[model samples]
Target: MQYINPQLDIEQLGRAFQRDGRLLIRDFFEPAVVEALSRAVDEIDWALTYRDVNGDRVLSGEQLRSLSAEQRAMLVDGINLVASQEFQFSFCTDSLVAAAKRGESHLLARFMRWMADEEFLASIRRITGVTDINRVYAQATMYTRGNFLVVHDDHVDAENRRLAYVINLTRNWRADWGGLLHFTGPQGDVLESYFPHFNSLSLFRVPQQHFVSYVPPFAQGERTAITGWLIAA
Candidate 1:
């Protein structure tokens, strides 16, 4: 992605989301934080993968398949991972969940609140036109490197979630290296192809048909991001 702007005002980003039901905000995170996250990604293990719909083993340095019985249990119990396609990636980490459950702060918990900060949520609500969003339903939190999210929409009839907010954490990404978030409008037109750039935010209305392409990465590099939804509070 080319350098367009270095700043993203909350008000402008919020309005964009409200009008289009989706918006991409570039440079949404502080530069230092972005650098810290990139370093952190290097420290985390993201070597896990799963077979995509095409029966191909989807590999990523930012995501991995659940390894332990506890991890799988977390996915099924609505505490750790949330269901997407046929798998669940990490949202908040185990330590984070443990801390919150024990009334303490975890790294993952801090990240979640940062993404849902006042200005950020305002931008999301404006984009999604979601009223009383505090009624936020389910939030699927996780990190991914090259793991692909199969083409689909958020649960429409599932009475809780209403929107999907995908925030990019990787820096210096390219189109051919894969990890692009593609969206299809109701009319069947490809509406958006958001590149994976550091500190960028992509907010879309619930149930809009979309898919993450399986394009290979640049020599096994990572395309990291955190994804989840806002449900009724």
Candidate 2:
């Protein structure tokens, strides 16, 4: 499916980005494209991983194999050891680039490939004025009840990340349901919060402090999104 933006003007978008350091574009993708992407997300298998309070991955396939039976049980039962911050469930198709190199083809893979296309990158450059962007990185994330990510500036100078993006796919989400993206000021006070609205794209400049609030136990549905960074070559 083709990416369509019927009403957006690149110059206007760039002006807004310069004024605020961030932008929220609703209906960023065509309705049909969003539907297909949402279905693809539902069909993928997600691996659950734990992150410590400092936002470091503490448990995974290899790590689990090294733990004793009792340690494994504690992890499986969701018992927080001294280091854990929260649980994370996600599917990262990091092999898409490699598959493209080998001439592999699939609907989802092709869609992901388009994300790194020069045309797409050029469009982003016009909107954000980040002329150096030459690569795209992405992963699907599912934030179920109790999952969260703490505040941090997504800085990795070596990666040359220019913009962070999230494509929300969860419909009918309420503000009180949690999982909101909260941005903070340099003094640690909340500057703004964005609800996880379906088919909306949220973009922020690099080095911005932000966090995804916890999904509460009483939330009615899962919060799912495709998140990634636009990077320099």
Candidate 3:
């Protein structure tokens, strides 16, 4: 969020997204309209979370206890077991679902509004050349030591996701510290990768094979980003 008032050449970005099918725009996406919400990010209540077999969830201790033993075991042990090979993730998150429902006076609500603003959406349309984009969903994600996401293609019927985006906010991250975003090829070869560079915007077409590399225990700082999708709606 460094550039508060700098001009961005949307047409040029659009060309890049067109030619590459994915792009990493350095120091982009700092919307002055959402400056207040960006400032309030430190106050967010983070959920120490993992994606359960059921779906996206954030469980409290009492809530975890309330679940049946079988369910809880599957969500925790079973899912972790899957992580040994298959797709799974563990990280801190604060999905802005509830905040998006509030009035615009709320900082997060205003941020959500800004995301769906015609001016902003227009920029996205120009980039991807997918004019159907109507709205988007966003969540704050933080990867601390040991946090990881195994490879998976983002897809869900009726969601109509056009592309996925991640805006990194962390500073001074080292390359060897891990937590890089990696895209895979058909035979599981790494086609491309991007470190969680501070103040950068990453985008790729939806339903693409991608994963966040595991953060090693020796990682010096948190890997933080605002990630979400631009949807066709």
Using lDDT, give the best candidate's number: 3
- The ten-residue window of minimal lDDT in model 1 covers 89-98
lDDT of 2: 0.75
TM-score against native, each model: 0.65, 0.82, 0.83
- Clashing residue pairs, candidate 2? none
RMSD of each: 8.1, 4.2, 4.1
Output candidate 2 Cα RMSD: 4.2
lDDT of 2 by residue, 52-135 (tens): 345544344355467898985665455344225444332222234544666767546776688888767887888888888888
lDDT of each: 0.57, 0.75, 0.77
Q: Pick the candidate with the highest TM-score.
A: 3
Candidate 2 runs further than 4 Å off: 52-73, 76-104
TM-score, cand. 3? 0.83
Model 3, global lDDT: 0.77
Answer with 1 or 2, whichever has the higher lDDT.
Answer: 2
Error of 3 at 153 (Å): 1.2
Instruction: Give the per-residue lDDT digits (tens) of candidate 3, residues 104-173.
Output: 4666666666777787677777778988989889888888877788898899897999899987877788
Question: Across residues 1-233, which tens digit of lDDT does each residue of candidate 1 receive?
Answer: 21223455556666777677777777766777666655654555433434433442433434435346785454334421233436433223222233344654545455554544565555456545686565332222233333455667877575667777766777666777666888987787778888877777787777678877654424356566656677765
